[model samples]
Target: MNAWNEKYLQVSLLWFAESARNKADPSVVTKDDQEAYLRQARFAQGFIREEEPDPPMARTYSYQQPHALPKVQRAFDRTYATRGTQREPAAEPFATATQSKHMDHGQPTQTTSPLAPQGRSSGQIQVTGQWDKTPIKLSFDPDASGEAFYQTFFQWAVKRKRGADLDRERTTLWLKASKATPDTQAYDLELKEDELEELWNTAVEWIQENKNTKAPHLYATVEMEAG
Candidate 1:
């Protein structure tokens, strides 16, 4: 059997039996049960991680900071009552007019944007979740088998169109794979929970649209667990 078929068989059997046996065990988890329920799932994400706040600043200024000598008699006169301070004489009348001609307020400021990755991402697919499968190479897509084909549909989600709070609800992604495929290289992608949900939603949307024309075996929506 092809690698895809073998994995499909194993995943199906596992979710059917093993999951039921572990319903009471929090360690034995399930997610997207309404869609693709499994002991584990794998995917990658694209989001900026939150950073910790900076430490509070120390008191910098000192009362005697400007004094160079230790014994400082007040040489300077304090005119606080008079509020004594000399102001600059009014600028020559010509100063404002001469500088006004060069006012560059309307001109656009040039800015440089950092360059994006020049080489295209040869990244195959973001996921290659596996199950107990035979080691035989497949006649079709000998390298990636079928996982990449499904994963490509989900990878289309850009950052943020993916809803928030999706990750906390999802299961932990396992990098381990049962078979080696061309797309296997991307399987190790360390995707957070949010990214996985984005991909899952995108793939399901694609499957929903192409159900009749292409792969009919795939369907939309998560499978509600039989309670």
Candidate 2:
């Protein structure tokens, strides 16, 4: 089997075995069971692979201009110095517009939905999101694969923050797409794990067919888990 299929099978079998063991003896684990679990864990480890750093092409694609990083870093430092904390939020860092009516009025007004009236847009989708109470927006090619969509989103998010590079592993990210209307339930989804490609595709399909007149707003949050 391919790497993806092999890893999936390994994880599935591991979980099934664990479940059966728990059901057989919820209160206690015999030494044999412990050894059995370790063996299963070792079996699963064969399918695992370590993550690699972003490639040179990825850096170029995401940053667009390498020289711009220095400027952004200087600005980030100034903001952090003034705030006396590294967690100072970026001021609409990913937004295409410096200021909008939404910022002026302290209320969210539709800045221009990227969705084509009849169906999916021919161009990139302008996704709007709020992070740390700061409004941000970014564009994505709807035609891209779901994995590409997820990666670009995270890369953009990390670039917009002050100290994201330092503690990225400790961080957990998630998205909550706004409700179609006041009466509808919102779409809440997690990131930083498996099944993300499916989730992203589902989100795109939802946006395309949603009943709302405009594209729904997206809210993103990043949390650092305690060590």
The CA lDDT at 53 in model 1 is: 45
> Worst 10-residue stretch by lDDT in candidate 2?
49-58
Question: Residue 200 deviation, candidate 2, in Å?
Answer: 3.1
- Each model's lDDT: 0.36, 0.57
The parts of candidate 1 lying over 4 Å away from their true place are 1-103, 118-125, 131-227
TM-score to true structure, per model:
0.15, 0.34
- Which TM-score value belongs to model 1? 0.15
Considering only N, C-alpha and C atoms within 3 Å, which residue pairs clash in candidate 1? 33-223, 34-222, 34-223, 35-222, 35-223, 44-191, 143-181, 143-182, 144-182
Cα deviation in Å at residue 34, candidate 1?
Answer: 99
Q: Which pairs clash in the backbone of model 2?
A: none
Runs in model 2 deviating more than 4 A are 1-121, 162-184, 211-227
For residue 196, give model 1's deviation from the true position in Å.
20
